[model samples]
Target: MKTLLLLEWMKVRKYKTFWAFIILFAISLAGINYFIHNVQIQTKSLTHGMADIQIFSFPQIWSTTAWAGGFSVLLLGILIITLVTNEYSFKTHRQQIIDGISRKQFISGKWLTIIVFIIFAWISYFILTLIVGNHTENISVFSGFDYAGYFLVKMAVSLSVAFMFALLFRRSGLAIALYLVYVFILEGIVKHFLDKIAGGLGMFLPLSAGGYLVSNPMRQAIPGIETIHIQPVWILLTCLGYLILFVYLSYRYINHADL
Candidate 1:
């Protein structure tokens, strides 16, 4: 474990683009959360029962902020893909094998990066959780910090998707483009039609399943409580299955394909 982490650190330490990505991800997360906080503040003015309710309030903070913050996991996913593909672009993947690192170890290094990215992203949310909870209009001493676990799983699922793409394409530009298209367009269209044909079962699509895991509350989010809302344990299990599949496929590509 320590050696794998050391290898990952060696790759990340001097990489300016990696640092840029980390900085960008942090700023984007904070910016998005701030935007949501302000939007909630403004919405409170409207004459509706929903107004004056803050998602960051203590009890709801875990789930509400997680659902709100989950969107930025895509950025983290892209960074992971880029970091992996950059090795190939630089031919450093070949050199690493020349330097006596086994293919399995190389893949392990990449996997370590995924673990680290997820951890950093989760820590960022933890800090934001404190900040958002501190300044929100209401407080109740926090009922369910358990929902943060769901947020972490959602992020792992997102990063795993990117890892699989990077392994398959081996080119950052093409891989990232395909990932976005699949997530935003292809999946959207297919899920729409599939939902109609398969009943509500279409919600179990890879991305949709992750969304269901830390689903938004009925009050703050647009989706009806009955529709987007799913039992977290089931969604968690489903997403973990997807995550395992993604990692296994990526590992196979890395393990079997010539560098």
Candidate 2:
């Protein structure tokens, strides 16, 4: 696994765009959280007892950061698509195999890179939560491990879908644009109409199931907010199911492609 990661790193080590993504993801992650925390502090102080809501207070803070952190996964998605599809675009994917790496190893190396993204994201969330929890409130670091766990799993699913899209499309720009369209516009539209005929069906969509994983507690407090409630277990199962399908199909696609 380490060797696979090394190989993948060699490919992107000098890639300026890759570095730009790292910087962007990091800055955006921290910046957005800092912005939201400030907003929460300002507005909550005006409301009686809202200050004690624990939005950024330790245990609950873990979940809050997780929910916010999910937004940046879109960046990672674009990153993976650009990186993987670039291999095909530049014809280096074939060269890697010509240089003695099997096709399976080639795919594995890319997968390893995605796994690193998942781990890096998890660690970022853990560290940010740790720092904020310590300064904001006295709380157990491990109190909401379950939420953290779901965060990691949902991220894995998100990355897998991105990776699969990269493999299928092999055109970075198209893949990234299509991914955004499907997730932000296409899926939402499909879900909106689907919900009218069959309640709770939208929650089963790939992105929707992932959203069900890390919930925003603030949404629950809002009156007249209509949202479907599904069991976390079911949502998780749905996510895992999609993860498996995506990986299998992506693997099969690349394994047999003419690249």
Candidate 3:
């Protein structure tokens, strides 16, 4: 595993695009959370306490940051796609195999890279949550911190989905384009129709299952609407199922497909 990770690190260390994407993702996460924090403050002042929503406060901070982190994960997904597809574009995957590494090692290296990215993202969110939540009134630091775990699962599910696309397509352009379209348009449309036909079953979709883990905390502030709460365990299980499926499919492709 260390050899695999070190191999991935050697590749990533010199990759300018990887660093660019990492920087962009960090900025996006911080910038979006900062903007929302200001909005929450301004809303409180403008409404004169009539509509005070504590998004940055203790428990809510975890969910708020995790939810906000979702948007930034898109950039990471693109980065994953680029990294995987680059291996094909440059024929490095074949070179690695020719150099005595088995197909399993190559795919395992990719999976390790994905895990590293997930850890980086999760750490970024954790630090940002602490920095932002410190200014807000809160009793406990760890309250509602389970959202951090949910964020990890979300990242895994999302990046694995991207990895699967890259393995399936082997072209960055097509993989990324289809990924964006599916995430933003196709899945929503499919989920919409599925929900209409099956009622709530749409939540089982790959992204939706992960998304249901950390719902929008701000929605609780809205009046006259009952929020439908699903069990976290169920959502977690669904996400795990999709995660395994995506990883398995990617592994199978790499194991059998001619490079």
TM-score of each: 0.90, 0.92, 0.95
Which prediction has the highest lDDT against the true structure? 3
List the RMSD of every prediction in angstroms.
Answer: 2.5, 2.0, 1.6
Q: For model 2, how does the per-residue alpha-carbon lDDT over 1-259 read when each residue is reduced to its tens digit?
A: 7787898888889989999998898887887788878877766777765544667776777778888888888899899999998998999998888998888888888888888899998898888888776443455578877999999888988888888878878999899999998878998999988888898798898887887888775675466888777789998899989988987887787688898
Q: Considering TM-score, where higher is better, how would the candidates rank from best to worst? A: 3, 2, 1
What is the C-alpha lDDT profile of model 3 across 34-105, one tens digit per residue?
888888888789889877987888888999999999999999999999999999999999999999999999
Worst 10 residues of 2 by lDDT: 132-141
With candidate 1 superimposed using the best TM-score fit, by how many Å does residue 132's alpha carbon deviate from the native? 1.8
Which prediction has the highest TM-score against the true structure? 3
lDDT of 2: 0.83
List clashing residue pairs in candidate 3.
none
Residue pairs with colliding backbones in model 2 are none
| TM value for model 1 | 0.90
Measured by C-alpha RMSD in angstroms, how accurate is candidate 3? 1.6
Provide the global lDDT of candidate 3 against the true structure.
Answer: 0.89
